[model samples]
Target chain A: MSELYQQAIKDLAAKGSERLAVPDASSTLDNPLCGDKVTLDVTTADGRIVALGHVTKGCLLCKAAATVAAEQAPGLPVAQAAALADQVRAMLKGGDAPALAGLEPFLAVRPHKSRHDCVLLPFKALAKALASF
Target chain B: MTQSIRSIIPVLARAGFHYLDNAAMAQTPGLVVEAVASHDRTARANIRRGVHEMARRADAAYDAARQSVAAFLSAQADEVVFTGGCTLALNLAAAALAEGLGPGDRVVVSAAEHHSNLLPWLMLAKRKGFAVAVLPVGPDGRLDLADLSMIDGRCKVVAVTHASNVTGAVSDIPRLAEAAHGAGAVLVVDGAQMVPHGPVDPRALGADLYAFAGHKAYGPTGVGVLWGRKEILADLPPVTWGGGMVAALDDDGIEFLEAPHRFEAGTPPVAQAVGLAAALDWMGRLDWAEIRAEEMELTARLLAGLAEIPGVRVVGPTDLAARVPVVSFTVAGCHPHDLSHVLAERGVAVRGGAHCARRLMTALGLDEGCVRASLAPYNDRSDIDALLAGLAEAIQVLG
Candidate 1:
């Protein structure tokens, strides 16, 4: 039994379903190795993200990451959200976990280097979407 | 018997590594490793146009390797051109063949081709102004050549894989060969997946050209073979140019050597080629019929076991007819990567994802890709049991 697929991750992955038909900015990213894709849509106001939606067709790690992004990104400044993504990226590379409970479950993914991108795909998409803002 | 074969490969001696990733790269035997090391130690010198004794020895070793590859393909020594790998070999063929094509011409390729075999022609078509017509695959993952009109008068070449790396379904090469020849187009078969299993005769398969990699056939990496028909190669221009390929050079112009030499550019992978030849020699001496029977038996067992598992859907042909030992499947709720990770924890080595056949994956409706377990001669019942047991645990853990 791998700790990476714990009940908390599975619950978050099951909640990975929110999409905005129209948004101020949107970006799609794919893992060229496995062909897993994540498309994120964002709407911002007053230099802060007001709403976020994502359509992720990927593994549990990718879905869980997207769910966490959707849950924590709203009502936060764009730069802070970008920082969160960077923190997740840093944590996957053996750095300290992000100062958020949703992302703490992904600490088990640190050693599996190939799957680091799975946890970072939505975060990368979030950064890309925020960059357009 | 399997233990004896396993003993021949140094890496397989490791106790717990159940390697089911032969489709990516097979384990190299000790004979091939020694052949490469011995060549690098004793005969390491530039090939062709050298007066030293070391260069003479290098030339002899390289020429002998070419002859061995020729024998493996049932081809002439002058018809084989050694390339960096299978991708380069296919690119060499595509670039040279594209010269005869134009805007209105068409090149027919199957949907089951690896990216290496498909991308070169697609990229060449964009630059050379030719149309690429894709042949669709049936539900069983075999090419559906029912509509022969795609190979009409404008067809210039028919490029396809001899066996699909993802689905393991073997293509109907004779039918494809007849169609290509009927339309006055040449048939180029990507034999990378097929050659590792056994020797092949390109002429017998009615292919004008064939390409395969050495690393996938229990040989060293960085070496591959591109075998073409004598007359067809004689007429094609060289896609690359370098020292050994030029027979005469001046300020006015340059005259190239004949077919094989004209296509070989730069210093080739001499030691890798020597290792490939040694691998092929070892394969030739094996009882292929017995090995193939054992492989098919395992395939049958795997298929039956997969069928009994709920939510496991096979992506290729279900039976032992016209397929290799490669098996690909998908679980309903579990992603291939997740399942692969779980299986890895159990010491099972399998490949997940598109397997470099994205077009086929799209056609098969595998949005998240599928898990693939490919078998070689060295694998035994223990390997399959480990794979099945690992999958059960993976589903329980991830599903």
Candidate 2:
């Protein structure tokens, strides 16, 4: 509703950068009542992400999380993907996470504690891809 | 004038029994305090405890209330077994009939049943290894009974809802009952929605058993009536036991009481019963058909308005000609919760999400869920207009 929130949503929607990360498997998180769902695609090729993407529906936070997580941890290993999910989770929670370039899109999301998982969508998808492998 | 949101609304933001969002939690009227109030003042003693003046009075009130509920359903007082609520009543029906069945004993259930009706039967089949046949509903959310013909011979019990809580589509219960009976299965109707939508008479419906919740019908919470045939009640097994459910016990085993008591195991919700009785008594005094017709008019108006809104998909029957005021819908490209949130901000109460019929929604692939708007006789035309305005605003916000 605010200008920053609107801007953040627009920036995420632009989704200028696309990446095929190493970890191919991902986890899906569904908020049943809100009907917000995100599947994180995690793929591990030789124990590293070779490709990553997400299919999601919900609020701006959820969409932004998927886009940010994918850009941050695609080429990383299982450990790196998990760690990045943690960072995304931290950023969503208003906790401190290192300033990875693409992750800056999520800075607007920090104050809303309730949206932590929504902002963590992409990485969760990747985790699932990894878990399955 | 619209009924504006006096405060923030409820949101169904998660799953589980308490998954109702802040909006839903906010919208739900609290009856616990009210339930307690009646308990201390009237219907206080163990109802029908007997032999004392106070007990005698309580017994008369309670038993007479039972008779009233029976009459409400066009049944005999002895045929009604008051349970904790709809859930327990359904469990009573399913578990009782499910007992003593061998492998291949079939149970037929519609996909539109609420979790209260579906789960008990599912558990019964899983535990007993009976054949469970699930029938589907057409897009209108009513049973596609042409598909039901396939369930013949295998169905030991046919369980379905009188009206879907999610979609508000009224099922043809009498027809379904006939089909089940022809197949040698008893028909169990979950009337939670129907009872609230309008008055209902289960005996006339020819259903072997009917389960309805008091709260939704303007009665107190935690009290419900399950009306079954006198013969059917005698045949059912008791799932719970305590002071009243039993007649006598020996070293050999425990002997249960007859009809209602056999199922009602403990200290009943006395205040809740009294309140439910009061609600029923109040309802009986009203000209009900007029109330229902007024509600139908309101629903028709709401449905027409919703139809005019872009991206709105009303999920129940197309024939607004044959349904309750309860309605369900999904907004294309917007999650139901988002739509619900926008409306709540405007103070229009609505139910969002799967509505506890998880498997049915899954089968329909409406897993994200839809928004439900249930109207009572008290709701009026202004409410419909307000709901339409609120829905339009919600769509704009999402877009």
Candidate 3:
């Protein structure tokens, strides 16, 4: 349990956020398998993300991933923000953790194949939101 | 007795692997496995085709399987139709019944039905211009029959589950049958969950048609049974068509066979049917009264143990009066999938999701669904204890 549910993950997940009042781009995604949902609202400026807000109603992994996305999404280029989701997906498939610092905690989730979607759902919403912008 | 039952299933010999996902698929028994293998090895031929020795053997085995399924439902052999699975059987019923229905005709279904039972009617109703009414589920997860007016004069069909796969709440089929009959509607029951517990007399229960999966009954996959009254089945048109189901093919048109033959299009799952018969034969010899008593005791123990846990809420009826041994629950501040994963790490198997019953989940106010622990005859007290202990740890792990 400690291996997967590390204190860092718990803390990050506890730092939940709400959706933005008015956003440039927003997207909502659902993991139909378990009914986990994540909605992302982004504020973009000068062709880059300046702020990220999220409303995630999912498992601990999903919530923690969404928090990590929210924290690191600021100042990220639109192309790299979408690629970050791909990196996390590849990481879940036994690839190295993305260069992002906060994503390493999700390394423990690498062994759980089914929960991969849970960890990636928020990142997917972020990608979709970026596309919408 | 439990030990002996467990010994017969090869997988139960594995240490520390507690399986509680019997609702999805029961662990196959050695007898059923061997029967399938034996049929494939000895009687491997297309049934109802040539007069060759192998064909005769295969035909005998297939007919015997039909007879066994018929006996289980207390119906005649000619009334049974083998299908790929319970979903296909329900789809066939819907497609065949849709022919007689049109606009202004109402087909009443329950809110507690699995997607397999509900989707077929909804899809067919859209095409046939029939209205589909839902019977509401009570707070306890049982169908609320207080308003039987839903089955009014315009009603043509009443399709529902005999027992809910998630909640394990058994329906009052007799009362439902009475209501359906009073409205001059046919009652089609999804018996996939109930048949696994024990043999059910669909006719006695006031059903015109019944469907159940073979795999859930400890039989081979790719086989299911759909039994309807002889007259009703004769009237129902075939949903599928191919070589074996037809009689003669002229240049102008093709002549189809009778109910069971017309419905069994293409080459059927002969070996799987043989295996289902063997499984049902083994189940027939068992004293269900004793087994059910033990199952109820386990259900009682499971409910009590769940009650002792903090923030754990049972989704279905808390009592064991009219339910099977299936239990579903959710934990506060812990998602069911995460908890199920933690339990899987502890070698406890369970299912977590809407369980293909989205309507029921919405009715129960479960946004993330719940974890279910379904029991079979081979499951004993140790399995229940393992699940309870694993859940305690899962709460801590995901909390």
Candidate 4:
């Protein structure tokens, strides 16, 4: 239960509606159902991500996911962020994932399987943004 | 309107409706399923031809289906022309119009139109060099009715959606018709969102062309109806040519026949048509006013619950009066996608994002978009409760 609380907090804090700054690169993703989207921007210094920023006009989940990704992605190496995203995917997909050690805040999300893609939207946007550059 | 019937639908069930994300498709009545399967085999033969028993049965089934849709919509059997879906109906109108357009003519459309309603006009405008007049919508997703003044000299046709698929705002078609008529322009309506939930009188609305899909109306997919006045159809060109659309083929070109058959190409949908007919048959038994009343109740509950959450702003009008139950909104703290996910997890189904109304969203100052909860008549009390409960849970957990 404590783990669930912590994960939920971290998960809840990441919203795509709010702009969060990243170290490098930029990207945007769309959610077609309710007509919402999140735009992610980042700046990379050296091999490390140094800043993250975002602007969004969507609902809570998109804004929260962006905020969380912004807060978490800074100081995370580009490769590590990529790896972390995969872990987050595993954690989001299954009941148990060791990569979720830092993702404990999102543990309460197990029941929302259909929305797994929405929760992962920020990372996908960031990845797409970075990949383009 | 009555109590005995209300308790039987899925919305009234304890488990609620989203486990399968399928309403009519899920738990299709045993008899209906069997009927569909049996008719599928029987309908393989040609209609209005062939003396075989199989062909006769197929023709009977097809005719029966068309009659059913006609009765359900309160239109004559000749009014319904089964197409792929609502998009096809809109496309057909555009195609017919395209045949006559030489250039310099203007087409008037609304900014709040869904892609299905807007794209065809855009394509036509681009290809034909016809001026396109985009009607504006109010900040709350209502049509800027004054824009009707823009329908002037150059306007050759008016294309508009009866209701916005995104904001659920119902446009005043009668007023729009008056403007179009005043401008001497033909009025075309995209009824995809309007026909299923509301009552419509094509003649009363004074539209030359009207189209809608069966899928959203609790009917089968791949079947839509385009209702055009007989005179208008007689004057307009056909969208496709072949099999069903032809009257006679000989030396100097071909002569086309009457409506419906003129627009339909190849072998008609047959099975889908039957399913749509069945859906329409069932729909006729319903008291639409009661359904609208129920939707209003659900809309109120959904709006109240959404409004209670901080940073959660419901888009569209605050008044539930003129609008249907399709609700779209954005949140200050959460992205609609994220919020939709949270709700999705809780077993509540909703749509999020721009809802294919980019111009309307842009005009409303919502660059990203909003979350939408489109309520169907099948949605009852428990459905609304579940949605509210899920939203509250999402807000607490994420906000």
Candidate 5:
């Protein structure tokens, strides 16, 4: 197994907290090409994310990305979470990696262009959910 | 046999690429590529129009292509009509046949049909108010012909695939033709998959109209053949109108050319047609028995290897006699897209998706689709070995 699959599997096995209570904002994103789906729920307090939960039915890469997002979302400002989404997109597109410690694992996926969408699926849903807040 | 055939494709040796996606688009032989390039360089001009020298040469080449295609299908020269591609050919047939029908007319298509065969009829049914009935496929991935009650005298056409792209199962065309003929309905066959794997004589297959794409048969893209009986061709009206198809036209009325000529609109794909002829010629020189024998061996290896994997489940028939070498499977706990990506990383190319037969995917309960490895004459046991190795690596990585 390559370092990429190993790192991605580490995030895929993460167990996060429960769904945000009556979630303040939620969004569902689907990749029509492969039928991968990700639904993200966000709860914000004082313009900061209080909690986040994700339900993903897709590839391991997608689920892993969602797990990473859920782990890093709590206590972060909504704007920062949205910015992290942008950073993730840039990282997948072969740009320089962001300084966030949690995002270091995604550096392994840089060389695979076909999997960029898989890594971005959860990010896009989270961005939409954060935007609603 | 495999080494000899592989020598004709330069990329196989140069790039060391294991091409397992022949069911989608075949790798054009070096000779066929040269045929297309040489035609473009030397004899490129508008055919059937100008009276100049180059025009005449172009006309001769185009005519030769038509004759070659007709001969390949065991059809007369006048029975063949060239179209943009297989989809266009099927659409043309559907449009022309639907013109003679009314609201109460019916058209029956199998559930296993590619979208190209199913969509045209559904569009025609919507426009002409004809009812479209679907013939269900059994669990074995073969069409259930047990219930032919839907194909009654009211049925105007019965369109089906000669072989399924997803299942690799060959349909019993002769029996279908007989049933359609008994019900006074014309049989239209989508021969896109069958023609590439073996010889197909449309008349002997009892099809009134047969459509196939050139690229699927190691020919160039943008060219396809639609062969119909002379009488049937005459009865159907031309769907497209343009400069080349008409004999004489005025504000009063228009007189069109006969049969095949009337169907070709605007400028035809002359070079592509030539390439298709060259491909057919190349295929004709090969011994089909040898090709089939090699493919069967490779297929056996693939099925056996996949069967050994605990989580892998093969779709379609498990027996060699029932299908071709097109094998589709789903791996537990692994998405097909991810698996395909891993295989591509390993320098093996295969198709992963619904394969343009979403209905078949649904029928097989593969909601997330499956990975497909399709074999061709150029493929040998080593290619299958590479595939199995790649698959094993994918499972280990994605696990």
Candidate 6:
């Protein structure tokens, strides 16, 4: 197994915290190609993510990505989260990985072009959730 | 014979690449490629339209290709219509038959059919206000011919695949034809998968119409064959009308040519047809008994290796006699896409996702789909071994 797959499995096994209470914004995103779905709920205070939770029905890669995003979302400003999502997208699309600690696990997915969507789907959902606010 | 076959495909000589996606598209032989290139270089002209010598040469080559394809399928030249591909051939057949169908008429299709066979009939039924009935398949993915009571008198056409693309299960064409004929319905057989594996005699199989793609049979892409019984071909209306198809263009209406010519409206893929003929000729030269034996051995190895894997579950029949060399399976903790990616990284090529047979995927209860490793005559024991090793590595890593 590649290092990315092992780390992704580890992240997937570690569950995120419970759902956010009365979130200010939420969004649902689905990748129709493989029927992978990710829904994000975020509670923001003073334009910063105070709490975040997500539900995902997808492959291990997607679940792992979502878990990482949800775990790191708290205390980050909404703008930074949105920017991080864009950076993740670029990184998955063969670009050099940015200096983000949580996103280091996804560096192994750079060689798999077809699977970039799995790693980016959760980020997209989070971006959408932030944009709604 | 296997060495000769291997010599024709250069990619097979590569050190590490193991190709197992033959059911989706077979690797073209060197001779087929050379034939098409030669035709393009020497006899490049539109067929059946000009008085120039090049045109005549092109026309003769195209006609000869039609004859070769006819002989390949055990049909007359006039009974074979050159199509864009198998999907178009099936759509044309469905549309031509829809002209005679009415509100009460029904079309019966098997559950194991690819979307190419099922969707066209469903679309035509929606447009013509006819009913579309699905013939159920067994748990093994083989169509159940015993309970074909659904093909009643109201059924106008019975379209089915000669073999299931996913399960590699060969349907009993003769029995299905008998049932359709007893119900007074014409039978259309989708031979896309079957034609590539062996000889197909539509008449002996009792099919009124047969469709197959050239690329899937080690030929060129963009060319397909739709062979219909003479009487049936004559009665079915032309679905395409244009340049070469018209006999006369009057102010009131247009007169079309004979059955096959009338169906091929625009300029056809002449070089592709010739390449297909070359592929057929090459296949004809091989020893079938040897090829079948080798394929059986490779298939047995694949089935046994996959069965031994902890997380892998084969989807089709367990017995070797019940299927061709195509094998589909799912891993316990791995998604098909992820598994396919891992396999590809290890220099193995296979297919993932519903394989254009979403209904069959649903029937098999594979919500996330499965990985398919299909074999061709060029594939051998080494390819199977690579597949097994890659699969084991994938399971150890993912499971």
Question: Which candidate tops DockQ?
Answer: 1
Question: Which docking class does model 2 fall in?
Answer: acceptable
Q: How well does candidate 5 score on lDDT at residue B304? A: 98
Q: Residues A47-124, candidate 4, lDDT per residue (tens digit)?
A: 666677777544444455666777777787776665555666787877465432345545565666645665677777
Give fnat for candidate 1.
Answer: 0.91
Q: Per-residue CA lDDT of candidate 2, range B1-399, in tens?
A: 012211111222211112112111212222333544655675467864568776776777677768878877878888999988988889889888888675978888888888899888878788999987788888677778886775588778889998888777888988888888889889999988888655678878889999988777667678888999999998888887678777789998888889888888878776667667666665666676777778678778878888888888888774665577777788886667656656765667777778887866776678678888887655657667777887787776666
Candidate DockQ values, in order, are 0.86, 0.36, 0.72, 0.39, 0.48, 0.42
Candidate with better DockQ, 1 vs 6: 1
Best by lDDT: 3
Candidate ranking under lDDT, highest first, comes to 3, 1, 5, 6, 4, 2
Q: Per-residue lDDT for B1-399 in model 4, tens only? A: 423434444343545454222211222323344557778766667676769998888888888887787676567777777788888989999889867774778898998888878888888778878878899888787889874667986788899988787777888999989989998888999887777675577768888888988777666678788888777777888878778677888898888878778888777777777877766666667788878888788788878877887777778887787787787777775656656667776777776677777888788887667777877665656667777777777766654
Higher-DockQ candidate of 1 and 3: 1
lDDT of each: 0.91, 0.71, 0.92, 0.71, 0.87, 0.86
Ranking by DockQ: 1, 3, 5, 6, 4, 2
Residue-level lDDT tens digits of model 1 in B191-263 = 9889888889999999999999999999999999899999999999998987789988999999999989999
* Selected candidate, larger TM-score, 1 vs 4: 1
Task: Tell me the spans in candidate 5 whose CA falls farther than 4 Å from its real position.
Answer: A13-29, A39-54, A69-91, A95-112, A124-133
- Report how far residue B125 has shifted in candidate 3, in Å: 2.0
Residue A120 in model 3: lDDT: 97
Ranking 1 against 2 by DockQ, winner: 1
Fnat of candidate 6 is 0.29
Clashes of each: 0, 45, 0, 54, 0, 0
Distance from true position, residue B284, model 2, in Å?
Answer: 1.9
User: Which pairs clash in model 6?
Assistant: none
Candidate order by decreasing TM-score: 1, 3, 6, 5, 2, 4
TM-score of each: 0.98, 0.82, 0.97, 0.81, 0.90, 0.91
